[model samples]
Structure formats: structure tokens, C-alpha cells
Target: MIVETPQLILRPVGTNDVSALVELDSDPAVMRYVSGGAPTPRAVIEDWVVPRAVAELSSRRGGGMWVALDRSNGAFVGWFSLRAPRHGTQPELELTYRLRRAAWGRGLATEGSQTLMRVAFDAPDTGRVFASTMAVNSASRRVMEKSGMRLTALHLGDNAETDGYERGEVEYELRRSDWESARFVWAVRGSTSELTA
Candidate 1:
């Protein structure tokens, strides 16, 4: 396990998790922002997503997708990731999360993301942590904001999955130095011990 919270367990995802992943991606709403509204097919999950996820977990030094499990019942809630962009060699990492519809409206996304950011910034050589989403994805934007990220950029792209992309996409970022400073302040204030996310 990479990290554990009062309500969730974050662990490296493996081949055995294929079924759970397929089910999650099969939901139209879950894949809305990613595929422009198309549910990911099972063959793609088995042939591409699963293998790529497993390889990334094994090779990435500071990040990978983690399966989120409910602490009480051990159900697969969803998955979260902190890693470099798919086609880039930059050291910067991107934060991402996708949960089942049943898990929406809860704070699980923020909780898991906070844990990953800690891991990211604490690694001595780590750089900035970033996250991006469609401008209309207010729920995800809130999670990034609550985790201490701020607006960094606006990227215009061709997203035909839905008309929502007409508003463009937004990126949020947090530097390691800033996060470290905040950690120091929380430590001095003795609030670190009480922090949940």
C-alpha cells in the first residue's frame, strides 16, 4: 500500500484489478470528461489500460495509479494517480482521480489526492504537482483547490465528446517549495497532527 486514510486504502493497481477497472470505465459519466462521453471498451481496458498501468507502477519512481478500497468493506471505490504526462519526459507530475458514481459527492478524491501530493513533495528530487480538467468539471476543480493547487493555465483543445469543451480546459499546479513551507507552518501550529487529508 502506498498510503492509508481513515476511510480508504491506496495501493498499486495490478492485472488482477482489470475487472474492477473495466466496470469503472464502463460508466458513461465516469468517462465523460476523459473520452468526451464514450464508455471505455473492455478490450481497451484489458489490452491497453491495464498493461500500461502495471508498467507505469513498476517503472515510475514517484507515482502511479492506486486502487482505492473502502476501509470498512474492501470495495473498489475507484483509482487515483500522480505521474508525468503520457508522452513527456518532464519531471513534473499530474494528479488524477476517477471514482464510481456511488463514490461521488464524498471527500474521497480530496483525501486520496492530498496523500499523493505529500508523497510527491516529500521525495527530495520531486518538482511541481499539477492537475487538469475541463473548465466545466467543477467537482474535480474543487478537489484540486481544496488540496492547495491554484489556477496555472488555460489550454484550448479539440474535445468532441461533448459540447462542454467549448469552454476549454484549466490546469492547476503547486510547487514543492510551497508545499514544504505549508507543511512547516502546519507543523509549527501543531495542526499537522489533526490534519485528516
Candidate 2:
């Protein structure tokens, strides 16, 4: 599947993205919150990450991973995913995004996340969309809030060795009912503006 926003084009990840994924994970800054600045080995991306993404895409169970690209120049910006919850049932997908350092502070993460949330809720079966990040990762928290998800829980840390793990994790969620209400308000306001115009 393919999706587009004004600033990005998101498509299913493939073998071609292995190198790009490696480069993205290689940046200590990019992986700071994820792996405590340890670069993901290229072999992992090739053997495990890419294959899993491919399988997710093929299964079409919940939304899979999508590689985000710059609309103007087609640069590899990052990847976004909405997948079935590991510990939860269907219709409750988890949202996630990982972008290159160059993409930070550009609002691209929020843009992509908002788009995916819409995609999830557009499906009649989807009941909720949620995400989690290290509590210390203010940037990611802001992205989740900007995407209309509210903080639902705070998970205590269990692994001191993990970077940012000492600070714990925050979970955010948007329910289908809330999303529908917000969309309705936007639709009404849009029509009002058009009528006034």
C-alpha cells in the first residue's frame, strides 16, 4: 500500500530499504532512545527486520510498516508503522515512527502519525490507536500529542541497562469515538468556512 501527505510519500518497505534502514539505525543520535546509541547491525536489518516487514505487508493484518520519503526529492526520511498489539486484541493497533536525524524538528513525525491514525480509524474495525515512548523523549511525546493521542498510562522501568529506561515509558491513545467526534467538528468548521467564503 501507498500513502501520501503534502510533504511525504509512504510506501511498503522492501529489500531495497535494508541499507537505508541500517544507515538510519546506525546514527547514535537516532538510536539513542531505542538502543542507547548502539547501532543496529546490518545483518539484523537484512535478515530479520526486512523479512518481518515484508511478511507484515503480505499478511495485511493491521497496517504494516511504511518507508517515508521526501515528496520533493524522494529522500529516505524514515519509517512509520501501525501493527497489531503484541499483547492486545485486534482493532487496537500500535503506532510507531523512526526518522533520520535530519527529519527531526520538522514535524514530519507528527504528519506521518496523524495520517496513519486517520488510516486506522477509517477502517470500520479499528477501535483505538496507541503509541509508547520513553518518558524522557519529549520530542516523541509531543508528536503523539500533536497526533491527537492522550496519555493513558505510565509504565515503570524494568531494565536499567537500556537508555532512557530509567525514566520509564509513557503510553498514549486515541479512541475511535474521540477520533470520530474530532473529525466531525473539523468537517463542520470546514463547511462553515466554505459557506462564509
Instruction: Score each candidate by Cα lDDT.
Output: 0.83, 0.86
Error of 1 at 80 (Å): 0.4
Worst 10 residues of 1 by lDDT: 188-197
TM-score of 2: 0.92
Q: What does candidate 2's lDDT look like per residue over 114-169, in tens digits?
A: 88887777667889999999999999999999888999999998877777798899
Q: After superposition, how far is residue 66 of candidate 1 from its true place, in Å?
A: 0.5
Per-residue lDDT of model 1, residues 1-197, tens digit only: 46788779999888889899988988989988888757788888789876777776676457678999998899999999877678877678888999999999889988888888887775566688999999999999999998888999998878665768978999999898788787778887777421324
TM-score of each: 0.92, 0.92
Looking at model 1, residue 19 earns an lDDT score of: 90
Q: Candidate 2 — what's its lDDT?
A: 0.86
RMSD per prediction, one decimal? 1.9, 3.4
lDDT of 1 at 66: 90
